[model samples]
Target: MSNTLRISLIAVASAAVLAACGGSDDRNDGYTPPPAQPPVLNVTKVDGRYHHNKSQQDSGFRAMSDMPPSASPAAEIALPALDAQAQTKAQGDSLGGPILIALPQTVAQAQTAEQLASLLHWRQDAQGQQVAALRVQAADALGIRLGLLVQALPDAALLRFYPDSKTAQGYETTGAEINAVLRLNAQAGEQGQAARTWWSPDLGGDAITLEIVLPASAAAEALQLALPSISRRFVDTDSDAALQAPPAQRAGLSKERIPSAGSCNLDMSCYSNGSAERDAVARMSFVRDGKGYFCTGTLLNDAIQSDIPYFITAHHCISSQTVAGSLQTDWFFRTASCGSPYLDARRTTRTRGARLLYTSNVGQGFDATLLALNDAAPPGTYLAGWDARLNNSIQKVLSLHHPNGALGKISGGETQNYANCDGRHCRAATDGRGRYYEVRWGDGTTEGGSSGSALFTQSGHVIGTLHGGTASCSAPDEPDFYGRLDLAFESGLKNFLAAAQRPF
Candidate 1:
C-alpha cells in the first residue's frame, strides 16, 4: 500500500473534448489554456503486490501434549524501558530517528519446549470447542526468538502484528496481554486456509510487549510461533512484496525523499483550516516484500450515515483480495503543529484488516476501490462528505492526504481541463461519466503516500480521489488526475455512500 500506485506523467496524447454540454465547469472563458504540449514522460504503472511467505520448521523445538509443572518459578528478563515522555515531548522529538536494535537474547530450543509444556492449557476456542492454548507471560528472556517483541517506532502510536506461519492461521492470538487481541480466523486466497495479519491502537506508549498464543486442535510436535521481522518508526514489522520487484527508478530524485515525497511546506496546510473533516484523512502503511510502503485514503460518510467505517482508496493500492485483507490504516496521523518538522504524531487508532468491496480496472476509467474497515472508526473520527454530480462546474479544488506517510497536508489547484484519456488508454467521447479532472496545482504537490486522498471542491465537497499525475515541486507545471466521484458514486459506491437513511 505504500507509494506503489502507478503515477501517470503528462504524456504526448491527442487531446479530445470530453463534454459538449459544458457540464460542471465553473471556470471563466478566459481561463481556457493552450493545448498541452508533448510531456517529457508518460504514465507510470506499478502493480499492487502482496508478500506472504511460508516459514520453515525449526528442528530444535518439539511439541509435547503433557508435562509436569515446573517446581521452580519461571525466570524472567526485561528489555530496556523507553522514556515515552521524552520521545513525545514535542513535535521535534523523533524516537532517536528510527533505530532498529536486534536483541541479543535467544531462548534455547530445549528451554522453549519446556516453557510451552509448563504454561499451555486446553481451552475452548471462540466457538467453545476445546483446543490446546498457551499464554506466555512477558519477560525479556522468554520469547521464541531474540526479543520476540521489538520496540516499535518511539514515535509510533500503534502496533500491527502479522503472524508469519500459515499453520497458525486457524488459532493464533495476538495482543492478548495488551487486551487488543486479534485472532487470524479468516481463510484467504485459493487455498482458503491462508493466514492473516492484525493490528492494535498505540498502547499509549512507544514500545509494546506482544503476547503470542498458539492454538491447536490436537497436541502436536514441533509447533512454532513464527513472528515476522520488525521495522522502526512505523508498525510494518512484517515483510513487503514491493521490495522484491525491481527497485523503482526515481530519475534524479534523492533516495531519502524519493520513498516519501515532498517536505512540509506552508502551501500544504491551508485548505482545511484545521477542521474535523481533516480527521477523515489517514496515512496507510503496508508490508509487501519485507519492505514498508506508504499510501493515503479517506474514511467516508454514507448518505444513510450508518457509520459502518467505509474507506476509499485507489484500486492500485489495494487491488487484490490478499492486499485488501492485509491493509493497516492509521487514523489522525498528522503532526501536532502545522508544517512542523516530521515527528511521530501518528495515532494508535488503526486496523490491520479490511474487506474489499469493489474496484475498477486499472486500465479503465476509474482506478478506485471501496473497502469496509473490519473495525469501526474510533472516537473523534469524521466521515468525509462528497458530491457525485459529474462536471458540476468545479473551479478550484483542494487535496488532503499524507504524502510519503508524512503528517497530513493539503494541496490546491484550479481545474485546468477535462480529458478522456492519458497516454495509452482513452474512454469513449460520449462516456461523460468516465472523464477525469486535469488539475494544475497552485500551491503544494503529491507524492507516494498521497494516493487515494480526497480531492475537494471550493465548497469542501469531495469530487474525486487521487489517481496519479506528474505534479511535484520539481515539475510544478506537470498536471495530475483524480478518479471522478460522480463516476464512482454511480458505479459501485452509491449503495453505501448514497444511502438515504441517517444514523441519528
Candidate 2:
C-alpha cells in the first residue's frame, strides 16, 4: 500500500478506536486532534549545561553583605511535622504511582504583594541596585519550594532562590518570565487555586532565601511579589549527606548505608551494556496542587534524529503545561557503580522546567504526555529510539525507573496481552483492541514513582509508557499495564516524533 493510503487508513481506524473507547467526539468539548504531520521545530544546540532562563553562574548577590542584615529578619515560619506512618500508608494506597513528598503551608502575611513587601528587608547591593530579600526557614526540612502569585512585577526585576550557605548554586529567574509562565498556564485552562502561582524549584536545605534585585533605575515600590503558601518536603530524595563524607570513605561504605529500592530491585548500572538506553531515562520530580511528587520520563529521538529534548511520560502524571513548567529532572540518578548502592554523588546535573506539547489521558484510549524542556538535556544524555508500529507479537521488554524516588532500577518482562486498565482493575480486550500493553514481570517489579517509565523492546526502542497496575515485589506474578506508545503516536505524538526535516 502507498504511504499516503496507509496513513489515511490508520487515521480512520484511530477515530473509530477512540469512539469505541468512549472518548469525546465533540470538537467543541475542548479536544483538539493532532495534525496530519509533525511541524518543523527550530532548535539551537546549547553548551549542554542546565540554563533555565539565565546562566546559573550569574550570582545576583555579590557577597554575604549583599543580603539583608540579620537585625531586620524576614518573617520566620516553621512547617508542622509530617506524619511518618501516614506517609507510608499514602504510598501504599497510591494506585497511579505519584509519591507525595511535601505538605503545603499557608503564609498569613502573603495575601498581597504589598503585604509581602513590608516583610522584606530592603537594601542596596554593591552594584548600587535596589535589593529586597526574604528568608524562609523550615527547620529540619529536606527541601523548600515557594509558590509566588505574581500580580505586578517589573520587567527589570530578577528573582533568585538558594540556601543561606550556597550563594552561587542559586536558581535565578526574572519577573517577566514568571508572568509569562502564568499567562501560559491561563491559556491552557489552568485556573485552579494554584493557577496564578508559579512554583520555585526545590532548593535543597531547611532554609531558603528569596532575593529580588531591581535595576538601579527601577523602583522597588513598583514591584509585586505575593507568596500565598509554600511546600515543605519531609523526605530526602536528593539527600547530600553522602557527599559530606570523604571521597575514600564514601567509596568503602556498604550498600546498607544508603537508602534505595527493594532488595529485589536490580540496579540499572548492573546492566551497563545498554548505556545509551540507560542515559535516555531520567528521574522526574514535579509540583502539582502545592505538593511535590515523583515519576519517570524518557528523552525521545524524533524520526529525523533531532536533539530537541522531546520527552515522553504518562498523561496521568502531567497533562497540563502549568505542571510541565514546574518539571525538574535528575539525570544519571543511578548508583555510583554496578552492584553498588551508593548514589553517583558526582552526577549533580538537574534540568528545570518544560513546556507541555501534547497530552492524552486514559479516557482518551491511551495515557501519554509529550514535553519540550525549557533547557537543553544534560551532557552525554541519549535520546531514545522508538517503535510506533502496533504489534502485539513483540514479546521481550525492559523498563528502567526510580522506585519510591530512589535510584534507578531495571525490570525485565514480556508482553502477555492487550487490556483496558483503570489502574485498580484490568479487563482483557478480547477483540484485540485494547489501548494498554499488559505485561507480567519475571526479573523485577515497579513501585509508586515508576509510573510513566518507558517499556522498551529488546532493540532498545520504547513501545509504551507505564500507567499503573498491581505488579510489585510482593506480587511478582501480577501484571502491569503500559499505555501503548503506538496508540499515542497515532493520536498526536506523530506530530512531534514523525518529522522529516532534520533539526538545524
TM-score of each: 0.55, 0.81
| Positional deviation of residue 385's Cα in model 2 after best superposition, in angstroms | 0.4
Q: Which parts of model 2 are misplaced by more than 4 Å?
A: 1-75, 82-95, 164-169, 236-259, 349-351, 501-504
Q: Tens digits of per-residue lDDT for model 2 on 1-504? A: 101000010000111111001111111122333334446433211112222222242222233434344332455555555577866675444434476677666777777887898887777777778877787876667778888887778877888776665332457778777777777677666676566788887756777877788888888788877888888777655443232223553433222222356667777777743456877788888887677778889888776555678888877677777788778888777766764545665344453577777777775457778888766776667788788777678487888888877777888878877888653456668798798887767777887778889988777788898877766777666677788888877776776777556322
- Candidate 1 lDDT, tens digit per residue, 1-504? 111111123333224321110111111111111233222211111111111112332111111112122222332322342244432452122111111111222233223344544444444446433334222222321112212221211211112222222211111223342222122222323122122322222221123333222333323232333223222232222212111111232222111211333543232333444255567777775432222345687877665446667788876465544445445566655544443333223333353456666666434446567777765565666777677766545376777777655556777666655545432333333543346676667667776567678887655667777766656677665666677778766665665565444311
Global fold similarity of model 2 (TM-score): 0.81
User: Which pairs of residues have clashing backbones in candidate 2?
Assistant: none
User: Which one wins on lDDT?
Assistant: 2
lDDT of each: 0.44, 0.67
Error of 2 at 174 (Å): 2.7
